[model samples]
Target: MKIALNGRPLTDQTKAAIQALLGELARRGAEVQINDAYGQTLQEWGVMHPFTSLYTSRADLFDADFVFSIGGDGTLLETVTHVGERRLPIVGVNTGRLGFLATIKPEEIAQTLDWLENGNYSLDERVLLHVENDRDVFEGTNFGLNDFVVTKTDRSSMIVVHTWLDGEFLNSYWADGLVISTPTGSTGYCLSVGGPVVLPRTNNFIIAPISPHNLNVRPIVVNDSSRIEVRVESRSKNCLISLDSRSKVVDDSIRFTVRKEKFGAQLVKVKGDTFLETLRSKLNWGLDIRN
Candidate 1:
């Protein structure tokens, strides 16, 4: 079986962890490969194995049986973009704080990997978003497993966003920004911006305003099939549109339409792990009150 490892740079502990994982895979006789960005980090650690290959392009991962995301949720998001529509299952190993998406703890790496080899796992399918802009910022179309956000940049003033749902006008939001998050991303920036947490398998989407001018404009949830449109009108030169972590600059005259993609991303979950279990453990969702 082939497994591709991807992670973030600028951290020494992550570098060591990758080396140890690569060594373990070799001992188990499983073929291993590293994303080019991470391969450089491995070489810097002075670890080399004949069974390992370095990925040079997206084509290198087409045949991978599994993709191991070895960092925080951000790195996992990055790995998703690289996976595109290949639908390869991914296992996120958390090496950063607030690992909602990167659910596997670092200490349980060996056990989790063992489950993978023994087929003791579940493949959870998560929804993805399709984002398009009237302006020619993106070459074609883009997809995000996490979310699509339209925000005012650091120097930009608060913008007015006119929204429509399934061809019906929703409301005009005057705020710092707005977020259209997937069920997978509801716990992320969406939560920070007052959006409710949604189950990973829920067929819903959320429109959460970021610091809205009116207190009555609460975050709204809608069916995934709804076609949503957002028109940005800012006093500044441009506005910021982000699909997951990738962003593009667009003129104020641009309009964004976001909806669910035809397919979803498949994530590898080890046996006996549940999404709510992670929530209670990670977020202390039901912890007792104490001073």
Candidate 2:
């Protein structure tokens, strides 16, 4: 088996865990390949073993049987983008807080690996959002595993967003910003703005307003297949549009249309781990530790 490794700098504990994992893989005669950025970090650690190869492009990711993300859920999200339609499985080693995507714990690494090696796992395909800025207001078109946001910057005036669904005018929103999210992203920024926690497999789209000026205006949920168009009308010359973590300045005159992409991201889940389990663990649901 071949595994592709990518992540942020590992801590001492994480480094030890990685070393142990690599040793076990080596014992099983599996090859270890590091991503270009991570390969450099490994050299700084003074490891003498040679990496199978250093990968900087998505094409290199297709060769691996699995991609191991060593940081947090963010790293796993970044890694998932590299797989594209290849259906490459992701194995995340959580090193950060609130790891909804990176559910595997450092202490459970060995047991998890044992199960993975023994072919004990299932997959969950998460939908992705496609953003089209028809006016070329932002940079090259990008994809988001989370949500896309159009928000007012430091400007004092609130922005007005004219929204439409399937060619039917919805409502003009007066707020700081707006977010259109997939079911996978509903738990993120959407949740912060009073949006519901949509099931991962639900065919739904969540439209939530950010600090709407009117108390009567609230978040709305629509079909994922619905074509939603938004035009920003802000007093300021500059507003912000973000796809996941990537953002750029855009003129208020520009319009954005968002919908479900033709393809979705294939996420590799460990055997028997369900989305509800992740929500319960990450959100501390049903936990009563206070005394």
Candidate 3:
């Protein structure tokens, strides 16, 4: 088996767990590849080994059977960009707080590897949002596994986002910003702004306002197939646009559209894990102190 490893900067607490996982993979004769950035970090920490292949670009991940995303949910999202349209299955290891996407724990690394070797895992396909504009916004990849956000720039007052769905006028949102989230992202920024949590397979998009002037305005769900067009008018000359973790400043005159991507991200689901279970555990869904 061939595996690609990618992640953010590792902390002292996670170093030992990573070393143990790597050692076990080596003992099992599985080929391991590490992203160049992570490889450099490991080398600086005196943990780089002879068995690991280092790669700097997505082209180097062509032969990987699976990609291991270490760190938190944000790290897993970054992994999706590397996987791109190839639809490579990613196994997320949580070494950060509130890991909604990176559900696997460091203690479960060995067990998870056993399941993978024994063919006891399934793939969860997650829809991605693609951003379109007259000119390049996000260079190279314009798709995000979580959401696309439009907000006012710093020191700017609230912006007006004229939104349309499938060419039909939706509403002119007067707020700090707007969020267009995929079902997979319902638990993220959208949820913070009162968006309903839709099941991952629901094939829906959430349009949630951020600090709307009208308290009665609520988040609305739309079919994933619907095209969402947004034109921003801000007091400042520019506004901020973010696709997942990447953010950029754009002119208020720029108009952009978002739609569901043709291909989705594939997440590896090990046996005994379910989304409902994760929700209950991570969010403390049914827990009550008064009980």
Best by lDDT: 3
Q: Return the clash pairs for model 2, or none.
A: none
Winner on TM-score between 2 and 3 is 3
What does the lDDT read for residue 273 in candidate 1?
A: 75
The order by descending TM-score is: 3, 1, 2
Using lDDT as the measure, what is the rank order of every candidate, best first?
A: 3, 1, 2
Error of 2 at 196 (Å): 0.2
> Which is the leading candidate under TM-score?
3
Off by over 4 Å in 1: 49-51, 134-141, 154-156, 289-291
How big is the positional error of residue 244 in model 3, measured in Å on the Cα after superposition? Answer: 0.5
Give the C-alpha lDDT of model 3: 0.91
Candidate 3's TM-score: 0.97
Query: CA lDDT of each candidate?
Result: 0.84, 0.81, 0.91
Which scores greater on lDDT, model 2 or model 3?
Answer: 3
108-189 per-residue lDDT for model 3 (tens digits): 9999999998999999999999999988888878999999999998755889999999999999999999999999999999
Q: 1-291, model 2: which lDDT tens digit per residue?
A: 888888787676667767776776777777778888877876788554446777886776647778888778778777766665666777887877788888888777778778878888876788888888766543443677889899998758898889999999999999999999999888889999989999988799999999999989988889899999999887786689988767888887777889888777766688657899888878988797772
